[model samples]
Target: MKKEFMKNSLYVMIIICVIGFIIIFSSGAIGKSMQYNYLQKYENAVPSNQLERYLNDITSNFRTAGQVISTLGGFGILLCGYAHYKEL
Candidate 1:
C-alpha cells in the first residue's frame, strides 16, 4: 500500500511539473503576442489605459504562478526521491 502510494505521488508530481512547464511556456507566448499587438496598434508606446494595465498585471501573475508551481513540483519530486531511497 505504501509503495503504491509513493508511486502515485511520484506520478502526480511529474504531472504537476509538466503542467507547470506548459503554463510557463503558454504565458510567455501570450506575453509575446500581447506585445506584438500593442506595438502594431500603438507603435512602442507604453500601456496607457486601465484595461491594458490590468492585462499586464494578469500576465505577470500568471508568470509568478507558473514559477511557484514549478518550484513546488521540483521540490516534491526531490522529496519523493529521498523517500524512495530511504525505503530502499
Candidate 2:
C-alpha cells in the first residue's frame, strides 16, 4: 500500500511539473506577444492609460502565477525524489 502510494505521489508530482512547465512557457509567450503588440501601438512608451495598465497587470499576474506554480512543482518533485530515495 505504501509503495503504491509513493508511486502515485511520484506520478502526481511529475504531472504537476509538466503542467508547471507548460504554464511557464505559455505565459512567457503570451507576455511577449502582448509586449510586442503594445510596443507596436505605443512605440516604446510605458503604459499610460487605464486599459494599458490593466493589460500590463494581467500579464504580470500571469507571470507571477507561472513562477509560483513552477516553484511549487519543483519543490514537490524534489520531495518526491527524496521520498523515493528513502523508500529504497
Number of the top lDDT candidate: 1
The regions of model 1 sitting more than 4 angstroms off are: 29-51
lDDT of 2: 0.75
**Model 1 over residues 2-47: C-alpha lDDT tens digits?**
9889889998998898788888878857775776676677666665
Q: What lDDT tens digits, residue by residue, belong to model 2 across residues 1-88?
A: 9889888887887787777777767775676677677777867676557546656676777777877877887888798889889989
Q: What range of 10 consecutive residues in model 2 has the weakest lDDT sum?
A: 46-55
* Top-scoring candidate (TM-score): 1
Our tally of clashes for model 2 stands at 0
Task: Report the Cα lDDT for residue 34, model 1.
Answer: 74
